[model samples]
Target: MPKDARNQSPELDPVIHPINRLRICATLYSAGATDDRQMKYSTLAELTGLPADTLSKQLKHLEGCGYISRAREYGSTRAKDTVWVTLTEAGAQAYVQHVEALKAMTEGL
Candidate 1:
């Protein structure tokens, strides 16, 4: 666990601390354990049980933080477009560090 220099407390990543964001990161991490980590936007939405709009907002925020990236394949219709989501290398590292911090904080309990 990386700690603050002054207080020596484990640091939690604010971007990944939200419940929904945490779930999204965990889902992406689990998918990454497989051969291919890239997941379709709709598939991610289904797995997370999050509405499309909500998922889109969360993904946007993660992308802004360089935690995730999205690629879009245009189809005939906007609804038919396929958006692929993947966790970036930086994102994977941040998620792992965040989880470790969480574990360290809870280990005493």
Candidate 2:
């Protein structure tokens, strides 16, 4: 077995793996759908306290996993386009896992 691997014990909580992904998913989870509440790139960066480049990489990863949807909305004229972020169905589930991961990482020592 590798130094770090899934625990065979069913007693242990089946969460807390992939801490980085959990953090990313947690941030995305807080940002609801555009229809519910549009989330801007800057806002996400501010809320997560992550740099734009890091956020961009995370966004691309999440989008590839079918967890989040990123859209560049442009107005008719020439103007700064808006970047919209929304959590997909998979994202919602991943968010739940992320929460569970936190609990597992910090529950009862």
Candidate 3:
């Protein structure tokens, strides 16, 4: 492998390795490809096809790892409230590095 590819050989991130967490990170990363974007909680739930509780649990784990951040916006009615999720800078870097590492590991296979 080239030096650059070798340099990319970091371990797959444990925090984002789980299938659900990987899906969440991938969606968030692609959604914000052009800019630092935030996705609504409901939208994520729909995309992931995960039950609310399960998604919440996965998100909580990411947040605890400093890989994601969440904010709540309140409207006049409780039903109008929105929760937004964004991948943090550190999170983005970690995700990219993990992908690179995967690529590196598979280069000669």
Candidate 4:
């Protein structure tokens, strides 16, 4: 457990602390463990119940932190382009650790 500035308790991961980010992480963490580890951007947006723009912004943050990878594939036509996202190994570990931290925080309460 990592301490915050006051060193009172384990600090929650800022990256995954937001509700939307936590939802995204949990979704990706479960899916990544399956045979099909990749998901379409649209599918993820649907799963997270977030608008396209919001999802894009959140995804950019996660990608910036090396938690996930985004790949854009273009079809023969311009409108056929599709984006796919997958969790990196680091992301999996982070998700597990975050879940454990959450559990610890609630254990004694």
Best by lDDT: 3
Better of 2 and 4 by TM-score: 4
Error of 1 at 31 (Å): 0.8
Candidate 2 per-residue lDDT over residues 1-109, each given as its tens digit: 7545544222322231344445555666665553355577777777778788988887787778887788888867546777888777767775676566556556632
Worst 10 residues of 2 by lDDT: 8-17
Question: Per-residue lDDT of 80-107 in model 3, one digit per residue for the tens?
Answer: 9999999999889988887887777788
Candidate with top TM-score is 1
What TM-score, over all chains together, does every model reach? 0.86, 0.66, 0.84, 0.83
Mark the regions of model 1 whose C-alpha exceeds 4 Å error after superposition.
1-7, 33-36
Candidate 4, poorest ten consecutive residues by summed lDDT: 1-10
lDDT, residue 94, candidate 1: 86
> Which scores higher on lDDT, 1 or 3?
3
Better of 3 and 4 by TM-score: 3
Please give the distance, in angstroms, between residue 70's alpha carbon in candidate 2 and its true position after superposition. Answer: 0.6
Model 4 accuracy (lDDT, Cα): 0.80
When sorted by TM-score, best at the front, the candidate numbers are: 1, 3, 4, 2
Candidate 4 lDDT over residue span 1-109, tens digit each:
5455335546578888888888888888777632246898888888889999888898899889988888889988868899888888887777777888788788742
lDDT by residue (1-109, candidate 1, tens digit) is 3355534546789999998888898999988822246898888999999998999999999999999999899999998999999988878888988998898778741
Cα RMSD (Å) per model? 3.5, 6.2, 3.2, 4.0
Put the candidates in lDDT order, highest first.
Answer: 3, 1, 4, 2
CA lDDT of 11 in candidate 4? Answer: 55
Q: lDDT: which is higher, 1 or 4?
A: 1
